[model samples]
Target: MRVAALDDDVEELDLIKSTLRAIGHDCHVFTEGAALQRELRRETFDLLIFDWHLPDTTRPEIVQWVRNHLQARIPILFVTNRRQERDLVEGLAAGADDFMMKPIRVGELAARAIGNLLGNALKFSREGAWITCAVEALGVDWPVRVEDEGPGIDEALQAQLFEPCVRGRSGTQVDGAGLGLAFVRTVAQRHGGKVLLDSAPGRGSAFRLVLAQAPDAPPPERGQGEAPA
Candidate 1:
């Protein structure tokens, strides 16, 4: 896939480009928004990797400009450190396809890009250790389910569901710094969807990422991947 990485940070740009190139992707690095827009006007890329903050512009403005002005529908993947709900929504509203945080590893980025291209959902197992995933969004109604036999969530945990540094007190080690819910929310919203949470003290929590269809998502490959285990 051909990718466009827009950021003012040179190191980040290099890291993204090099990592993407290493993973069988062609990347075009951009240091400014104007040059990116100029190129955008001239050609189409398979995917976009952008940042929330640029040298002189905001991501939402650029996203809106691209969505409103451009005729093609290109999938966008945001690599940002901002975790504020408002920031997430703004990016989603700006026409970004997804948002990831800083301090990210290259493998996760590749999985996300590959998943979006192939129409997949990336998640973790109940243990939160393995990368359990599924392809081709489920064609069911809203209020889906993510029920499992793992540790159940509580009200406090629900409030901190998508936040970082949250853990359950069942004595089992919970992995991650709380990037899952945030990532899930970002992915769901970008596809015109929402994430539903229903957790019990003993029963496992069911996180339903309810989403509407994208206007022009590529045809989904038949079921071949597994959901978060």
Candidate 2:
């Protein structure tokens, strides 16, 4: 599997890299947040592994960043010391596919990695950590809006806001999984839908999803279920 490992601690990174290599997976390690962000443009990994804290960004922020910036439903794993249920819930809410505590579980990591690889290959299509599917109970028309802080789609291209594999040039170093957005776009179009980009350079982007009610979308159960992403 193509795995990306991010951590501020050099020694910890080395140990994780060694353990993963022993299992025979290609691992990419990044210590600097900006460099890692840049590298995301260049590569698409099967698994993304990182710490809960980073020099430049928090785990939740990085997760949210990926949801906002990339469309691919790449499985993300968190290796961190944040062991509280609240912490785990926060991480899960932020988009972590799974969260593992520190003092690393090498064996479990291997299993989870294999499982994530299989799970992603089998399905792997969605927008966020959890999918914002239509609520069957809601009326046909729903409140939705598209906001863009950039110049427009034209500027989105300039800013690398579109799909990674789209027309945008790879001038900026980015290690991104280049598959999700295309699916998002395709699915949205199939449903006679559209995505609104609420963003701008230095401002940020938020894409509002609006769709016709899905006759197939199941009703919400008692427990909060995972979103489609």
Candidate 3:
């Protein structure tokens, strides 16, 4: 795939380009927003990797420009240090396809790009398929569960479900890069958490990411109304 990466940090730009290149992707690196915008006007790309903060502009502004001016549907993958719920919501609202925090993991970045593409594909093909996500307190642990009503995994494939490049039998007909689950597992483990899966053929799947919470943490405050989309 041809990818365009934009970041102000030289080291980060080099790392991103090198990583993408190692995986056989042709990457064009940019250190400023204006240069990227100019390139976008003259060239097309399969994917875009961006950092939230740049020397001249912010991610939201660039995202807005892409959405409103360029009017392109190219998948965007954000690689940045802004790791907050509101920040994520803002990025998604501004039309980014995926977001990853700083200290990039090349393998996970590839997997995320694949996951975003696969998710869009699934949305179009799977009738009545939907996802349910929730965050719940499990004693001193908080488990985030993402349940999908798509075709479930077969029993034989359950054992290595989280292994890299191991896609379930149900996904054979679906196009994917087969690294989504593995990346999920990696993120969970890195946070001193564990990933749990429950599924059977014809039964939907549920993945619970159990992360530790501080013992004395206060309960979450209820909001007044629905937040912005």
Looking at model 3, residue 98 earns an lDDT score of 78
Off by over 4 Å in 2: 105-229
Considering every candidate listed, which one attains the maximal lDDT? 3
Best by TM-score: 3
Deviation of model 1 at 168, angstroms: 40
Q: What tens digits encode model 3's per-residue C-alpha lDDT throughout 84-149?
A: 899889888878877888776544543453343245335423565666656666577666555666
- The segments of candidate 3 whose C-alpha lies over 4 angstroms from its true place after superposition are 105-229
The reply for model 1, stretches above 4 Å from the true place, is 105-229
Q: After superposition, how far is residue 28 of candidate 3 from its true place, in Å?
A: 0.4
Query: By TM-score, how accurate is candidate 2?
Result: 0.47
Per-residue error for 55 in candidate 1, Å, reads 1.7
Cα RMSD for candidate 1? 16.3
lDDT of each residue in 94-189, candidate 2, tens digit only? 888777888754334333432322233223222333322222233552223222222223454634433434432222333445434433443344
Query: Candidates' TM-scores?
Result: 0.49, 0.47, 0.52
